[model samples]
Target: MNGAKVDVRKVAGEGVTWTLLATLYLRAWESRLPEPILGDRYAAGAVERIDYDFAALRRRIRPASNQFLVALRARQLDDWSRAFLARHPNAVVLQLGCGMDSRMLRLDPLGKLRWFDVDVPHVIELRRRIYPERGRYTMVGASVTDDGWLEAIPADRPVLVVAEGVLPYLTADEVRTLLARLTGHFTAGGELVFDASAPWVARVAEDFRWAPRDAREIERWIPGLTCADATPFTTHHRRIPVRRYRALYRLIHAVPALRNAYREFRFTF
Candidate 1:
């Protein structure tokens, strides 16, 4: 896992594992840019710690489109979370299935909020080795779908749930159960930001990529959702600071597939 090249495919048995690698790759790529959309030094460090040829891995993952999209999606998520923190500085921020991402550091909540990075035991163990624990930040080693782990987080304050690239891995039922429990537990109400694919897109994604077997109908999953809206990845492209692709990105939005394939959502419960 150090300097020696290791097969990323074998190293990561789950989709989240590959997603984490892709994230690190995007962050590393951004770091080299003159004006990066996300200045994530931690992501660059994480990539170096993993023993693999990142360039070769990019080819394997189809870097031409995937890398740019990954970076764009991440920036969108970060923007929404930052806004939430601004409004509710004392809120509890729960990052479900947090996989080696240094979002907490990137946002720097500044001890105003209780930040919890929740993931499975194995990933948590790996994160413990890579990232240092900071004040007002706790890492919970448990599956996001498990309800018991939520107990560790205090429910007194408003909550902000950031579930980027997580809902797609969960089945429709699992998504339903998780959302219901979360809304129930946080009766005081909170905001949720997550990514979801359309049913048709989900079917195609499963055949060619890593997507849940059962597509999640997010709106139906949470009937009590206060404000649910689909935000296309391209919608946030113009907001990106990178000038290299600004013109090209604006032009591509005309293609429906490029605009709506993977949509993010912001909800209130």
Candidate 2:
């Protein structure tokens, strides 16, 4: 499937691409627009091509970050990360496999920072159509596994990597390879921030969590990289008791039986 390009126009552009939360975030963006909204909204009045009850989906997709519990987490992480980038004006920040996240708009960095939004070519292609890069924000169209893209990025500068809802879909080996490659290339004091699905919790996420990927084997993939427990609020989202929020989500979705539903981890390179 590598290098296979699906003409953005020709894909089965009916429902969502199954990137779940990211797609929902995009939808929220569109909901703010004064339309002729020509982005992902389909002819069927559906944003995602998936055949689900959109009404039901809308109610269930209320992100915790939108709530007090998750809102604190979001501000904490985003503020801290933005501050870090501010200090490392020349540092390279990579949002690997970024789907349709509006982090660029949120961070809204000026020309001093060098930021990249990296993902599969098609996603970048799609994002470009909606949100064009202005100055410092550039979209690097490549997967995290492909080192070829790294060549275009300056290795001399420190790298700050941010990944949200990405690794669980990868096999552990793929996760490690990506981590090793990133850490190996980063300058000292560089950091990578991301969250993980506790093994058991991650399994349940395959269906409920919405994004698809190759990250199921995250533990086995890379032999190194420290897991600095970052459960408390480090970014925009604060850490809720994993069990508490998972239960809330379960009860919110009426799936309370799901165990170990929320897990998180972070580390430096």
Q: Estimate each model's TM-score.
A: 0.84, 0.65
**Residue runs of model 2 more than 4 Å from their true location after superposition:** 1-16, 20-73, 207-224, 232-260
On the 0 to 100 scale, the lDDT of residue 59 in model 1 is: 75
Number of the top candidate by lDDT?
1
**Steric clashes per prediction:** 0, 29
For candidate 2, the TM-score is 0.65
lDDT of 2: 0.54
Q: How do the residues 1-269 of candidate 2 rate in per-residue lDDT, one tens digit apiece?
A: 23333333543243325453335444453434343121223212223332344465456555333333333333444655676677776687788767666565666534456788887776676666555687878998777777688767667887778776566666655666777787666645566776554445555554433222323333334444555544432222213334465455444333322322343345655
lDDT of 1 by residue, 192-266 (tens): 988766556777675322333222344556776755556777776775565666766776677877677677778
Instruction: Determine which window of 10 residues in candidate 1 has minimal summed lDDT.
Output: 207-216
